[model samples]
Target: MIANLLTIAGTDPTGGAGIQADLKTFSALGTYGMSVVTGLVAQNTRGVREIHPVPAAFVAAQLDAVFDDVRVDAVKIGMLGTPDVTRAVAGVLAARRPPYVVLDPVMVAKSGDRLLAADAVRELREVLLPLVDLVTPNLPEAADLLGVPEAVDEDGMREQLADLVRLGPAVLLKGGHLTGPECPDLLAMDATGEPVRLTAPRIPTRNTHGTGCTLSSAIAALRPQRSGWPDAVADAKRYLSGALAAADRLNVGSGHGPVHHFSDWW
Candidate 1:
């Protein structure tokens, strides 16, 4: 059966990130996509100007509406603006227990705007991390979650990965933030004997607005079709790279633009 993937995230009217990006990714990978909006963001590729959060109760209602009708094969959770919203999402996931859950710890936007609130970090780490199959965090987000300095090198990345795994989810520690020609992502889980390392040549591009959202959502879309996380992650990485490599082909906004979701087709 084709996978039904749900993205619980905020909105990006520019179609570069959040719910729009997630749905596009799901479709690009040949999966059915659904969404629950957590915040209404008024912005574009340039920057986020204003954010209007959805109430916690309504967030729960939206989740229920999806779970009640569809058989969700996997879920990709992005920006939850506040702690209460985080708890609401966690509560529903705890009750529903979807087969696969991927958390992209979306703390800051590519434009450097903060998407998640400061206090919400605690709730996400304490309540949400444990329930997910995998938690994908960039260097800064990993540091924020662990309450430590951002990893500057491979050693720091490994050190933080160890600390994060104890928090109760397999971690896909992205090394894109590190200043290097090549970007490496580490996937470490308790059951998986050794951590798998996947590296790609860093594609130089200013159009990387929703790279995180795209990668995580792509993993969720492919997980049900693939046998395991490693394969899904590897394939997702390839997709993101292609999207990044082809990003310049599209004319979007002025600032950091979005990667092409349909890079392979159009």
Candidate 2:
């Protein structure tokens, strides 16, 4: 059966990030996509001007509407803007227990705008982290979660990953923020020979608005089809690299635009 993917995130009217990017990613990967908007942002590629969060009860209703009929094979969660919203999501996921879940710790935007609330971080750690199959966080996010100085180099990243893996589920430490010619993301799993390193040559581009959203969504899309976590991570990396390489093709916003979701297609 074809996989059905759901994105529980905020709405980005620009279509570069959030629910829009996630649905586009699911379609590009040949999976059926659905979405539940948790918040509405007022801004474009430049930066987030304002965020209007949905009521937690309404968010629960939306999840019930989706799960009542559709059999969600995988779920990609992003940008739960408040502590109440996080708790709502946690309740639903705990009850349904979807087969695969990828949590992208979307604290800050590519434009350096904060998405997740400061006080809500604790809720995300205590409520959501343990429920997910995998949690993907950038260097800054890892530091924020672990309450440490940011990871600067390869050594710093390794040290942070060691502490991050104990937080909850398996961890994927993103190396994009780290200055390097090659972008390497580390996956820390419980299996033997853990901490598999996945690397790709850096694609120089300013149009990387939604790279994180797209990567995590692609991982969720491929999870049901791939053999295991490593394979899914590898495939997601390749997909994201292609999208990044072709990002310039899309002349969307003046600032950081989106990666080409249909790079492999038309």
Q: Which candidate is the best by lDDT?
A: 1
- TM-score for candidate 2: 0.98
Q: Write one digit per residue (lDDT tens) for candidate 1, span 148-215.
A: 99999998898888889989988999999988899998899764356788999899999999999999
Model 1, runs deviating above 4 Å? none
**Candidate 1 lDDT trough over 10 residues, lowest sum:** 188-197
RMSD of 1: 1.0
Worst 10 residues of 2 by lDDT: 188-197
Candidate 2 residues lying further than 4 Å off, grouped into runs, are 191-193
Q: What is the lDDT of candidate 2?
A: 0.93
Estimated TM-score for each candidate: 0.98, 0.98
Model 2 lDDT per residue over 48-94, tens place: 99999999999999999999999999999999999999999999999
